[model samples]
Target chain A: MITSISLPKVEKKNDPSLAKFIFRSIRDAWDYRWAIETFVTNNLCRRYRRSALGFYWGLLGPLMTMITLSVVFSMIFHIDIKSFTVYIFTGLLPWSLISDSAIEGSQCFVSAESYLKKLFIPKLFFPFVIVGTYTVNFLFSLTSLLLIGMVLGFQWKLSLLLLPAVIAVTATLILGMTILLGVATVYFRDLSHILGVTLPGFFYTIPIIYPAESIPEQFRQWFLLNPFYYVIDLYRQVIFKGQSPPIQDWAVSIALACCLLLAGLVVLKRNEQDMIYRM
Target chain B: MSAEIQIDDATVRFRIYRNPSPALKEMAINLFTRRSSGEVLEYYALKNLSLTIHGGERVGIIGLNGAGKTTLLKMIVGIYPAFRGHVHVGGRVTPLIEVGTGFDLEMSGRQNIYLNGTLLAHSRQEMMEREKQIIEFSGLGEHIDTPIKYYSSGMLGRLAFSIATMIEPEILLVDEIFSTGDALFVDKAAERMLSLFDRSQIVVLVSHNMNHIEEFCNRVIVLHHGEIVNDGPPAEMIDFYHTHIAGRGSNASTEDRSPMNTDFSVASPSTAVSVQEQSRFSMTSSLSE
Candidate 1:
């Protein structure tokens, strides 16, 4: 004789689990704010401690690169100087900001493995500090860009009001990418290698040197799909064209930034514990 | 405040993946056959171990290497998670897992004091209040301004110990970090440990040194291969440990002795004397003794 076996059914609850998780992440970050601030300040001071140039080095690298690039592209390629210098500077500023943030953010946790293993501080701050420092570096370059624009006889206009909005968009986009790449770098270290190769290619593809109109009609839609294009286009519109970004472009970029931010937060929350083992 | 640190059936398990390296051909084959042995390895670092530690109790944890002593301490301090059971730590935990683990070698000692103190959860104002006391205890005087990389291991250990012990945490979790300094520093450290016990109710010390275990801890827990074999007063536990070691030594010698001499009397006297000496030394070394 055989008896039928019955397993107990588990009850499923309908709840906003993600909201709870995000709330916990925010709480954890709040608890570890002191540790994060100390870590960042210490790291920043340590990097410049032995340097002869001190923080002047921050301004030096971008200025040298810009001068070299402007000479080669403007003089040799016979590029138009009327708005091209400001255009290139604007694009380069944000691109470098993103690239520097991405590279440093990806290595943050891996380098802090010793601290992470011994303490239970929030891991999000590693990427936050990396991006925060690079943003400071980017701000220095932005000042130089403004100075160069004035030197090139470009008129400053009210479209500069759109500058804050553009910065918000750039920060949002970088924050999302930083968090995502920071967590992913712990797992697939190969992602860092892939990013190193792809980032430069990405810059060239985004029309930092040329206008979007230069793209063939057949390829225009394909070009618009690249997120960096929208970011760089907004920079050119404000600084060179003296016009604010279109409502449609602003809406699309904001939505994309929000999506990436939320997605990155989700990934970071899920992998918070696993990060210890991976790193 | 109650000084008891209670752990009830706490278990910590880790899941690790074991993936076979798949060549291009293997990947293609697996796409169809799906016969690869992709498995997960589950390891229990600490099994269902429970302990109750009361105020003024210095408990020592003894085990062979990799017997989960460090894991247990880390869990108590909430550095690692427990897979099952409850841990109720009554007060602030200061874990001195390693001397100078968090010290930045490039930073000056004064700067590192702020950094280290902040990481240990002290506010700037709080650390500032204790600044004079910490420096005095460290005994580094003029060297406090120098980069920590210039400091010797003993100097680093002293700085770390002074900073850590200065916080006056309710519960202190110490690993085998006290062996870094010279005899003078060791005496200073011992004095500091005794002072910490005046304020800290529970002190969990993990060390391989039997003398340290017997001296500092009133009660001892014997762990072997991830399980607690005995938990009792230090005297009985030390005796059990010595007898167990002696039995293993005698058994090993009996197997390889001369062909004609099958008697086990040769391994008895010396083993007995060594065991007695060890126990006597442990008793005298005990803080209560």
Candidate 2:
């Protein structure tokens, strides 16, 4: 008979498997869910504390942006004021989630420097917090979009029930990109500035204000190759156009989201332990 | 039943780089050049350190600044991974390595307790349950609801200390925390720490103060240049670190060496110098023998 009398241990291994690394990091993200929720709550509370309107600001802020963009672009770009406003808000809100996550999420490790030096909080927790904050903001902007769309006589569709699916796909894609960019940002601090400069150019790549039909027939397929274009297109189909997205659009979005999510997790898993020293 | 620490030839190396962060221009150039550009200086913060502290032992780590005392503590707590060798720590570790972090300054002291507690792997319910204890121990009273930024540095220290010691951990890793807080609070903190010392299976204290180490620790380890120099009873180990490792440039024979430079400066000026010399002579003679 074998009798074992040993205690628990924390051992350092020269070689760590990426599968285990990712699994553990992901587990910690759930394990510390309270911290992430608390951070996001504190952040939103602080942001709205000074403003008199409080939670309405979450709604009216996007409405104001939509009104501003619709007026300027309607005349300049020769688009209809009503449909155009609805269209811009739909694309802009989702894109902001992506762009903001890419920009701020990159600094997840750098910004959390104060905390990282103190405890053993998982590296993924901050990235999740960043995602969580943006996700909440996205929901607010979405509510604002729906309210404004109804007032502007934009039609609602049976596909509206599927909005959660679109948001999930978009969020998964954004989260994956943000984690990858955030990890890379720790190694390359300059990536943050690069994101700032290129994000505007990336915005135009999606057909938010411009009509999708405007692209030349020869170049249309290549234009569709932009994976984010598919996500925005899906949003446009469901909310802006009041129709279900094409099955092909759903396939592209889900496939890209899955690929990006796996790659991001794999990258983070491989480099998570080594990151503490770099900071 | 108790925490055990085993570090076998553990080594940690840190790389210092000139312009370590890859600039946009450097990356753009490197894309075509096929070469790396940053100048890196690699050095070991810990070198082949083999140590085993059994359960129920209070170990004091005494060393001069830059002797890798903090690095060793971090390695044991699983912050910095060992570049070479193995480190196995049994049971939960609570590291007070660097305080005044893991908190949002804009958040109130009450909120910070939950934030920091969650960072220590405690659930929200656990923090909520301990909130009263943390507030009582911190002695912040009515000020607990105020933003942490409004609290004085000492008040923040109390809050940090209270949150860290809210529950008894199996292994408590402290780094010179006794230096903070006022006289009354330090005594209170010391009393709290001693109680923790009673409950913890292993307590590792890294302090520059010789008196605290001598009074509290059953065993002491002397560190010099990222390696363990000596390990034994607290009095002798502190004595070893104070004499041989403290004054690095001067030989033990140099009579003019300042005794005030080391922590063993409580004696009279003449006696301090002679005591240091005698301690130095005994260190060398013991090695020779």
Predicted model with the maximum lDDT:
2
Q: Per-residue alpha-carbon lDDT of model 1 for A123-225, expressed as tens digits?
A: 6666666766776667778777777667767787789888878888888888788889888777666667778888888787887777777999999898888
Clashes of each: 0, 0
Q: Is the docking of candidate 1 incorrect, acceptable, medium or high quality?
A: acceptable
Q: Across residues A1-279, which tens digit of lDDT does each residue of candidate 2 receive?
A: 111222212234666676777677789788889888888877677778767898778778887887777789888979777888887777877888889988998898887754564467777788888888898889988987788778877777787899999989988898888889988988889888989999989888887767789988998888887878889888888987788877988999999998988898888766666677667
The alpha-carbon lDDT assigned to residue B35 of candidate 1 equals: 58
Q: Assess each model's interface with DockQ, reporting 2 decimals per model.
A: 0.24, 0.29
Q: List the residue pairs that clash in candidate 2.
A: none
Weakest 10 consecutive residues, lDDT, candidate 1 chain B? B260-269
How well does each candidate reproduce the native contacts, as fnat? 0.23, 0.40
